[model samples]
Target: MDVSARWDNACRASLFGSFSLSGPDGAHIPISSNKARALLAMLCVAPQEAMERDHVSKLLWPGRFQAQARASLRQCLLILDRALEPQNITMLEPSHTMLAIEPSIVRSDFEELIEALNDLRIQEACSLLATIGNKPLLDQMDFGDQFRAWLKIQRKHVEGQLQIAVSRALVALDRDGDMDGHAQLSEAWLACGRADARHWDGKIRIAVLPFEQRDAVGGPFFLAEGVVEELVSRLSGVSALAVVARASVASVANSGRTIPALASALNVSHLVEGSVDRFPDSIRITLRLLDGPTGVQIWSHRYDGTLEGAMKSRPHIGANIIAGLCKAIGVEAHTRAARTMTASREAYSLYLQGRALTYRAIGDGVLDKAIELLEQALELDPDFAECWTALAEAHVNTIVFTPQLDRVERSQRMADCAARAIELDSRQGHAHSMRGIHEWTLGNPLGALDHAYEAYRLEPNNADVTARLGSFLLYIGHTQAALPYVEEAIEQDPVYGRNFAMLCAAHFNLENYDAALAAGQRMIDLGMPGMWLAVIEAALGDNEKAVETYFRQRLLMNSVILPPAGLAPMDDDARDAYWTIASRGICSGMEDDRAIYCQILDGLHLAMPDPCDASIALPAIWMGHAELVMKLYRKQIHPANMLGLMSLWTDVDPIRQTRLHPSFLSFADDIGLVAAWEKYGWPDLFPRSSHID
Candidate 1:
């Protein structure tokens, strides 16, 4: 009766599809008691193969007295021991206080499945998952409420893992050109329906590659790209699907990568690719929907029409493409009808030209020209919601990128255009996004968040909207919640540099300096301002690099003068003094609010700006002047400057210190942050349970 003597090394427990333990010879070991099987499962899934005896008892035998629960657990262990003895398996190692599974003696299929997926053993993972075949964990067994709660979480976790694994396997199969295998596996996966569809979770992610212009020797090449953008916008409305951003897809469209490589790069489940061939007065468009994982063509279609006819029929074509894709993917295509932006073909063409101009408005007078074009488009069709959104966007670019322009006038125009776009079509995500930006500029952080969330709900797949939501959340100190949105936006549009900046901020606030540094480096690589990198580098105890980075940023900002010499060997206090003065110089050559900011940084006690800018509080916060921060907080800063508070949560040296101050909670409470935290979860630096202490 020595269980250790009969221990079988090949014993394996199958927790998915069915609950069974098999011996080395592939024979099922009888485990008659469901509770015993549940007990085995509890141990297998538990971290480090161990769980406290009391906790395990409560989970398995909830509602029983503590002593009775303990007794039941003991009885369950004995049943498992007896069942495994026949297979020569010493399945568990139980002490008076803890129960531990003996991995050397027996292993679970779930563990093997996870290992296979992690190691990219796609074939093996697919095979193991196919056995589960969408079946619920433990099949027909039901446990107590406490146990059920634990099971529910585990089930969700497993479902997520399996979905990713299966998706990857399909992609791998497609890459290898195994069509039959892909077909079989696809069927198996479809049979196992997914349970999570919230936001972008457990959704079909697709990227539309820029359409090829076959006769581009002199034809309208931009039209090809326009087709892709139109399709991307149309597909983004589907709740069951997430579309990759046009910028990312376009960036890689001409790289000549294989289908599988394209899918991998975009992190998508499907790809839409096509070519546009020009005729004398018409065009021939051929579109193909490929399974993202397998590169197998699920559907293909060709449309031939006159140039004018083709431009006007884009909505109908997009609908057909969406329908075909959804049908092949086994998902419902619940899409809103595309609104006609303009009745005039000329206006629609002008709108496309103007919208494209806004994307690359860094050149001299580019934004001005885009604004002119969009305005003309509106002249012909003033009710065009999309054109209004595009006009609003152009105005915002002028406000932020063109410092020479009239900021107040541009801001007003941006707000009015956004309001009009929303009035025309409340469902326009970009319109809402522009309005969100306008709200933040007006110092209404809460209103900004409301508009941002509405934009996200309207177009969850849009990289810009997703990134904006993350940015708005970060502004209000919701760093943890903001992290995933930033991450998802980066995945959808990796080439867009702003999301990486947001990513850096999120990681920095969470005190993840290494990740923050990496993200900042990426932002820099993408040609964005790397001012945040200096802060992250400083946080990681690299003051020399931090100083170098800050100086470089100031130089880029065209600072009139540099930090004083002989600063390298300066003590911490002196170095901080130099840093504060140098940081203030970042706003050099600015006017209005920015000029006020510089004055505040210089420590000249002038009348405070209408909005108590949180950014202006940075020098004091970094100097550990908690009282100053509190004073500013009490000033009831303009609601328009509320978004600027994001600067206060950068997790720099004194930020954490400031939050830890005795009066910090009172300040937070007065600013309505405590209530926000209570509703949306506390920030990383100010956990609800620990901040009070």
Candidate 2:
């Protein structure tokens, strides 16, 4: 074949991640040695695809004698050429004075990226950039200092050019009034920026308002909710856009505020609003993309389709909305790959409705209804991974909030649902996260760790994944390692109550009592349950605040009994049982009552093995049930336990004298707790003398 034809049908080299050449059929052509691979990469990234022999030798062998360097270079080239020869393509052209790749014989993705940018083929350039995808150039290879320096400069130059091309493309699309094209480009541009270490905080933030329902007669009112949910889920996957949470949008959705006012309230730069009209055979959706600050409609579209057709077209409609918004702001928006699928529209809609209901139906009949809806969804489409994952999550919530249920059976059901989700789609991060929680509840810490790590890897920016991983680490007694992940989760999702709760637990474990108390208070302020706050207050010796917090929680539970329609479900029996136990402990100083209360609460909350004994021990200590606390401590320190370490805190000082017990001392010795105390001193919140006391 001629050179150009050969280039088209010959092996191509990938310089990103690991250096490797792939033949025409996409099989790897292994180079003989690291030096040979390095030499090839050096040539490919070199200016004009050519380098003088003397310069190449000096760069690859900076410390060697000139003759020795040149000899090494020649040997490396021979190895590389031999490796390329089997592919029937000329990769390198060598001469007495210089070496170069034949102009039309080989093509590099890096080179094509530059060519695409030069031609203003931004979309093609962006696609190629995704292939490189933040990987360091010739990532695994270690070369001489001179060549490394050249590689660094070249990588930076490539990144800069990619960023400029993306910026130019976005501007051009906006100027041409091609909103859909601009939206499609935004994701790729953001990916490039992220890979190049550019900040994306300057990108426009958009919120999708809950679509209003008009003239609906006995159809699913939740169809609007399902559509809005799908749009939000899809848009949130776009790294270039910051999507406001559905809860935030729903809070002011019907306030009759102007677009500018609503946008300011939600802290968003743009808004997407739509109205859904349902008829006998079809659903019509009219959507408008609005400028948040100016209340201007940038783009509007009307879509008419059957329910099934609308379900299938939601992604395309969402993309169009994003495109219009991005174009309005002189940027690009790229639709992310869809991660959810369902063969039945009814199943898909039911899943969305189930998720919505589940979020609102904690601990009550509504949760059961949500579960029923999800079960119906599964019956309609057994392969619906999202429904399975959602069902697993709903079961987990039941395990946490509905103590009246058969805890063991519920836990097993959760595990089964999560496993089914994984079987259907192992790549779904939600499945892995749910499975991790299931494993954690089963007291399989190592299995939990594996699933949690995989979930985090698949969805690094997902706040829920971050929280789960951090919580898993904390539960396993890796308090220090878990702190940053929890903190980052909080940063990413400041409004999330669970993140703050995890932070509180982490800080308390670290013996940063003041910080822990502050986090606990923040959780309470956010209208989340704060049973832990009372414990923290009691531990800090604020008995009055602890007593007040106890009553406040009771009052909160009372109010929840009459919760607004469709909100969190109320389990009166479970609430009453909890109250009866907790009230006895608080109402009197009787040690037996306190101990009973602690044990019952442990049975309720410690549905799984608690390696650190925090579930039983912390509450016992808070209630001043010193004897029961010591018993729980002994159980935690047993030799058969998987975790050799015990989490100690300053709050346990009232039982300091118990350290002299044979079991306590032996446990300390077995876990090196005493040695840790002697070497590193007591944790920041504890008194040094308390360890020996």
Candidate 3:
């Protein structure tokens, strides 16, 4: 053999799944003798490492006499040489005392896989995994006990490397937003029990169908839906019950599915169906608990009361219905335990009206109207815990919807209302959840998590609570861990757009751009802000889409439209700079502020300046300019006001780079992220593996 041609890329071998050899022209080179193939396999396992001739003989022909084994080994080598010589392949470099496979010509699948993983070539490793499948290493080759032992160790090492590579590949796919690839690999991993189940599949699932409204004269449209919402919220507190969220139930509410079919579609064991009848001054509610599998009515009840009486008697009515359902299902009745608040019928009616508005965005004035009604209800009955919770939510909405408003003041007010609600009724999970949001808005992630977990503990089955907690986890950098919760929440409440918003953020942070775009579009369809979608388009380098989305969103918000005609002719640098300023103006509705808008517009031509001014930092951060945002934080945004840390785990390209920057550790330490991570476990993007001293 011409040993000098060992480095030639003329031939290759595959040792995983099955063994095979191919020459440079892609013709299969047949090695008919079993011992000959075995010799080649051994050499291919570690092409760079030469094996002594005697050792190779003992392993391939164990228990044979030394002379006989040596004779067999030499025959196998001759067979291999004859097979390769036909293709002009020189794959061996043999010495008098040692044998070796040329590292270049005889390169194998196993060898390449290890190298890909070692070099952190995640995409290549993922592609290689398809060829590996589930076959045992060297499955086609028969070997002696000594050789089998060597194969076992080799297989074990290969398994370990593949596991790590697959994991990293999944992360890469997620970051790249390769949903199809992630789904396929995830399915394979799940089949082999490599992936954890998102949630306990054994939990008892139940769906509360939308209540039918049967009124001669139409009352408020929210009345019937509100009843279903209340029941769903109340039932979600029962840890043993996995109550379906309002959105999912609403989706099929009018689907006209039979009871059993509805149950099957929702994957639930029991179904609660009901109808509401509103008369001139009286209301009646009829409910039925059905055996989902058989579609048999297991229990039934009717409650009748005057409008005023119904509003005041709802707690008692809801508790009775819950108690009956729980008993029918063989569970204890824990309905509204420590959850009752308010006696005024009028106050309760106002609370219902106010609470309904918070569920969906109707118009610009909806939140203001909701806040007004909730305040009036509070005045009528000062200690209504649920009303206070609803008010806090409306306030949070105000802060989010109107950026030019005093966010700090509004956030503090929201915190106070949530705190009061908790004080009045400590067991209300929604109240704790609101308080958690307040903590997050104020940039105290650890405190936010503490409250969020408490809310989850209080309402282990609440879909809203689950989704909110998941959103918090994503924002705080636990991208992977947040996935299960987001998925679980969606399963329970698939129609709720806010949960989709959370899903979008999770995918974006994971670098799953396509998936993020899909989720964000879904969010917009469901009547939520398209701001995140615009940002995602920008991250994807789709400047046209991003610009169009920004203008469209501004129009939706009733803000002045800033045309991108100038952006079309600008170079990449100018476009980015213009966008950074434009997005800030659009997002903040600063154009309405006149003076501030002019100041920002004047600086549209300037580069991102050092020591970013505090006023522009928040808007800039939202626009994905985290480098400037971080500089602002380092200079003046920490300790006294920790709001800069709010976007710490954002997935925009610039922001993602910021997290990997060396200064991030110091920023994390200064903002108590390290301490929070230590106590609660590190986030996915910044895992303990990346922890710096």
Candidate 4:
């Protein structure tokens, strides 16, 4: 048989990293000499597996006499032969005129990589390339100067081919509208780009810590947090600045660290800290910007103004801070801070209080209180675009984070408020982002994409906008594309639990289970709900851990139900019944749990719920209730039903197995999911049928 024909059946040799020959039985024959490895690598990259004896000798030992160089080459070949002999493999075929590897007897990873690329098996090619990550050919070997120079050229040529193959694959995937595939390829491309040191040139990084309240009397306690929030928001508008997220700064603010320490922790070059003192009619704001490394004060200012004047002066104050930083860093500011201000002092204060309350606790009627306060502010000054935006966001959060209100009603209200904000200020990124969320919830991906892209275009450096874009991508099953945005958001605000949760979802969708688990844990550590963590644990096959996580989530939900405490109202009996079913499903050796699970399914059917309620199907599938899932699929075809695309999730195993069943096929056909999967490549876990790739 020819070498190519026998390649798969023959013993393999890997020369990319180290010199080793492996037999069919998988034992390795190691070759330790640098010259021997280089010789093998030279042949590995050869146009053919053979080279003329004199030509090889001249390349390896150019300065030596022809006879001396040939002798050295012969010695290196002898060493390589001896190494392969132990594996019962005649790897080297040497003659008086030409030398080569016994093509039918040996193969290498390089050949396999080439074959994979030629066949357009990009995932396999990437897997093979990962084995050679960042390592040059013959990486640990040191040969003679002439051979070393040849090796350098060969290494570059090989890497260049690999990169070209990757780029071609990316183009093909993009042309096919395979967003996930494009994202993975983009990741590999970015890894290559990161090798260049100038990738992040001329970027200014800063973190604004929460301003402290020097005097706590008279003014609302949330004033300090509110001021820092506004400062961070205004500073985020500057084009040249990379502002650290408020969540990340808040995480380290109470650590009793100096300005330098805080800056170091946040990975920023500048730090902003200050105090607010409130009196009957005026507020005193003291601000200082400090150098991150040396803790030197770069600028300081104290502004005392009437309540209305201070509320209106925030943009000017923020602009001055940006100017000072620009002057200190020798970089010109490209944009000025612009904020929509309310003429009513009470309205501004009410808006600030509402904003602060919205951040207090999830699922606690804090968001509702925020809405009430913002409504009061709006009544005082109906044209307050900022207040409208804040209210819109709060309404959306009430739907997303709490189960108290009707989702349909809140979504409509959120849309209205967002539209009002956009009418008042066409360029408000927050309004655009809020509208994007509303559109996504309404199952309009194209509209969501337009708004998300607009939000990012308007405020590229805004961490919130970046995170929103990431979320929208994930919602549309473009998990890989969502990665960079979420990562940037985390880079900007490391302490933000929502960003971490989004990252967890992105990693989970990518089948990076370990990274998903880590991000989920980080979300839990940061005091966010861990519903996703439970799913991650379940996916990782840790039933006990998943059950424990479920219990913790249950406790978290119950803990927030303090009656008459301004928290969202909950149906205790219904919540308890739901948890009971979930807990039983996760526990082992419980036949009764299975019966109870079936009973819950029966009751859900009997209740005759809305056909559009697709969320319940996810939990049913997670609990291995395939019948319920099929029923849900038959009832509704909502875009929010991501289960069809999330084939890699362990929770979807039962669903995947049932994809060929008559009911499932009908469901898929009726919902147009099969055609959707055909448009993009079928997910890895999808069954390979005649209609699928």
Candidate 5:
């Protein structure tokens, strides 16, 4: 440990102070020289993963001689070691390639500064007196161009880190169920951005229409208002649905249009309209789904439950109505949806009221209320597949951040309930979705993919189905493959919350930074709070005035990373294929990540034998190392340790690729790719661009 410290510490004499080896207790060591200190700081802050020598070379001496720079660095290291001895630290060691910091117990001012700065950002009250009192590094001496660049980089990074911390803190206040804190933080971020901050902020949209009357007699507006309020609470489950408040919607309740026209007047895709007919025996309510664009009836249904327990039951019924509407638009019903609907209806109504209190708590606890409702619903009808599904969904909902439940428990319960649902109705895409989640949790990638695909197969037009599949694809790191599905999901049901985010995230896997930005903006426009929104916004250089709402995330009690982590590389079939498509799409415009699209298929030179989606695939019998590009061609995967996984792509069977990409000429004479292209339908497909490669 002693020797490691000596080798690792980049201690040197500071121009502002005499040699020392002491912390506040005077054991801190100093850097050997200004240059050495800068070099050390530069290396320490470099992205932690592997880095090439060329990067350092480019940063230090863009137009200078390498030998001179190396000599300067070596001299600084020697002096720095001597300066570090008092603090029992070493700054560097001889390695196979280049100098590296040795494992050591050396204290570093840079590290301390970073920690201090980050802490300060979180709490403005954090004392900077110690930092202010500290002696400056080489304060009087000129550090030169290389050192200057390093300093600039450090300052940029430090400020960025601080901003993120502050923003995150403000956002947290909003998330831990604090509306006032949330509003304050959101306003703060927004104000800062609007004033001088580089980042842009998020926007909000809302729609409110007349409540379906339970009794045309117009008893207490509370019941009618409450029912509408309850429906908004249910729909808000979409997460992205900014269901306008009853007060706001009341202004337009008398639009006099049908559901479709009413929705149009409200400027929303969904319009909820109904009339409560009273009879001697029970209450009859008629509801309708209207296409806001054309003012046409998309779908309509009627319910005949009595008013004996209508207040509490209305919200759940409303949830069922919304879910039914989403399903009609082709959204897959998953376990999550079931949980939201089946939780305690009365409690859920309270929860809806709770949402109105965005003035008060977050909507998260709605799950607990939902669980209660579902439990009660089950008590009333144990064999009800809907009830079972909702219970499973409630359990799964808890899995997102529960300390008690493991992922396996969530996956298993969801699967079991879904299986039960399917036992009752195999055509239920939502049930299969649960089963797929189980397969994914169990490390069966193919099974997961198959289940997601099956859900789609069962309901080709379902938005939720496509959204769920896209989510599954993205989670597996096959982001490129998720794009089409996500887009279709959003298209099928534009109101499906988070669908746009999913679509935007798909671009991250392909490293399509620009497209990712556009996607983030779309979400902000629709109202979503996520890392991707900030990231893509950053990637696109749009630090205008959006994304301040993300500050609402910073106000909670938790310690969260801001801007979050960057996306990892695409290491699977799904990922590679998506990227291949994205890259080709960038220079070209391949719409599909499927193998049938020769653009992406052209990058693959491999195959899969037991292909889940593709009929013809490569065999293990004649396996070969897959090239990066080729791997992208196949949408397949191999799970890692039941948690991590390599993404999948389309199959790479020789026979399949022949049909998918076609490496041979039709006449069997020409061996060139152009001849193969000629045989394939590239000219017919992408008529705007011919194959240049």
Candidate 6:
């Protein structure tokens, strides 16, 4: 037996003993059987601490009866004891204990490698990690058939670490030397002819599939979403990886698309697929990775963990899968086994609910529901910066345009929420963007720009961050700087509406209204709200048509607010906005009865820019309740959400209505003036495009 070691170079070492392993002095011993020699190697490199008794039974006895199992376990232990005598190593008898046997002494190559890595010796970590590279583990496994779940877990953990160490080594080599050294270092990692380590290069495309419906599917199904979400969260945490976000990949699960098709559609080189199943006090999961384009099966495994006590510790299952897949792919897994953020199952469950609602159609009470769930997430994890940002955004969406709360009150609340989130963790781009928006719209533009820029810098890869910041910049009138960010945002996410408006607005302010109008037209074509489109078209010298489009949008807005006549899905907020605007005409006091499916504009409170509640009261004559209309406004009814006020006396007779409430007579002048203008055929607000042509 020979024991040899060199830190920088490959060392020649011999597993010496009576038969398998021996002492540093090269002592000798003799084991009668080869199976005993093999078992020693097996237990020696069990990856983790120890191999237990049941594992030995499953390995050799496999499907054999009671006598065969007992005999095999006894023979294996006796052989292990004899072979390891030289090294003073001994296997726990029957080998059925919880921990594996640890060698008493070693000249083993692995010992030195472990010592070096533990010493923070980079050179040793690399050389040692490289020594164990994908060489055969237990080349003569007399027990290959015994791959138990516990053994599988240990293998996964070690493999994950090996890949991470390999990647780290490659990185150190790259930083310390020339390209050749980096190339050679990378080449050295080519175990089994693939660089499949979990070292996620930023250039690699990644596609995250939607989590399996843990709850939707039933009992354990609820955990499916959390498993997938936690995995995504962990992968993204590996700073070097260019991991895709759950939101973008959610459409796959949300739309029920097949995994293979999604892989191709998303154009990622790899795919992770899995399902989570649950029983009382236990959770079982199945997962695998595939070569996305080729559909070749890469790796597949199942984990049956007991989530008996803490629900949150369940995310580890997801983390394990990700870490496992990265190991399978040859990427480094730096996952320190810990319960962070959503360590408890309860918090994970709430996080999933919040994520699920994020893409739902905007409606009254919907955003509020999401906010509630996110608030719960924050409660579960007060230090979770991501959840804080989500909650902050939910707050913003709640009063985006409620038109009820006072501006100062609402704005202050929004700013405070955004500020607290940013204060907790400024590195979070979403938090930075949220606070930047509050500053830009209600506080200081200069300060807003600084925050927005910081957000972009932090999350350069996220289009949402860029688009949101660009939109905020446009709102604050920083059109020039806004354009490039918006352009990049569009490049990142072509169809999302937020930045499209800002992109168009940039052109609009640049006096390239044609481009702006084209952009707006695209938004309109896609069924998005026409707010920016109308503005862009008007800027492009199409004011007449723009006004027509604007009025049409207002009409739609009004109908949207009307709560739908019969079985209409009035939950859409944009539609609600349109209906509100339509009911309150910009210049016309005259009724567009056809627009509202009515005979005349009866008791519909004609919105007037008066200091009193005369706007609604003046129209009461047609319907007859001046006091009732006054009380409605004073009751703090939101003007933007007046859905069902279509009353009697609703016909066009402003005079008759005003007569009932003399104080409302003043509105008669404005209505009459608007009426005369309509009666005489009102002229266009801007010259026709045809005239310009």
| Ten contiguous residues minimizing lDDT sum, candidate 3 | 559-568
Model 3 lDDT per residue over 1-693, tens place: 121243256576777767888887667889899888888888887665688998789778866888999999889889988998887767899888899977767667765664564344545555665666666777876565447656764564455434534454554466567788777766655554323233334345678887788887674534676577677877876665778776566656677777755765465667898898988877888889886645778789888887667666677777888888877765656654535657776686688788767654345577889899999999998899888988998887665543322555677788899898888888777778777776654546688788888988887677867887887676567778888888778767766777877777777777766667777776776666677777676666655556567655543433211222122244546556655556644344333432344456336424323233333554455544445545555444321123334345665554465676667777766655566687778877664776657
What candidate 3 gets wrong by more than 4 Å, as runs, is 1-200, 209-226, 247-273, 280-282, 288-300, 305-316, 323-338, 441-443, 511-624, 631-653, 661-663, 669-675, 681-693
Give the per-residue lDDT digits (tens) of candidate 2, residues 1-693. 122343567566677678787888778888878877877777776434467898778667766888999999889988887888887777788899988876455567766665564444656766776787777778866554346545654565455444544554565576777787677677765664443333134444577887888755675656777767767776667666656655446556777878866865555656888888888778888878876645778788787888777667766766776676566656556756766678687787788788887766454477788899999999999998878988987887665554332544676787789889888887677678777765544545466678888998877656667777887666444677778888767644545666777788777777777667667766775677676676666656665556556656756753332322223444867666666567556433446766688667566434433423333444554455444545554444321112212223333543333343445545444434445445434444435565433
Q: In model 3, what are the clashing residue pairs, if there are any?
A: 175-510, 175-511, 177-512, 177-513
Task: Give the Å shift of residue 615 in candidate 6.
Answer: 18
Ranked candidates, highest lDDT first: 1, 3, 4, 2, 6, 5
**What does candidate 4's lDDT look like per residue over 601-633, in tens digits?**
656555533433433555565555656666665
Candidate 6 lDDT tens digits, 68-149: 7767768767665666565554444333454354344333455454344323354544555465555443433334323332
TM-score between candidate 3 and the true structure? 0.56
TM-scores, all models, native as reference: 0.61, 0.56, 0.56, 0.61, 0.38, 0.47
The total number of steric clashes, by the backbone 3 Å criterion, in model 5 comes to 89
Clashing pairs in 4: 245-492, 365-567
Model 6 misplacement above 4 A: 1-202, 214-222, 237-247, 250-253, 256-273, 288-301, 308-320, 323-344, 358-361, 377-384, 401-411, 422-426, 491-495, 510-518, 534-693
Q: Best by lDDT, which number?
A: 1
Lowest-sum lDDT 10-residue window in model 4? 193-202
On a 0 to 100 scale, what is the lDDT of residue 215 in model 4?
Answer: 61
RMSD in Å for candidate 3, one decimal? 19.7
Task: Report residue 116 deviation for candidate 5 (angstroms).
Answer: 64
Stretches > 4 Å off in candidate 1:
1-165, 168-199, 214-222, 254-259, 291-298, 328-330, 551-644, 656-693
lDDT per residue as tens, model 5, 275-312: 66655567676666554434456577777866655644
How far is 658's C-alpha from truth in model 3 (Å)? 2.3
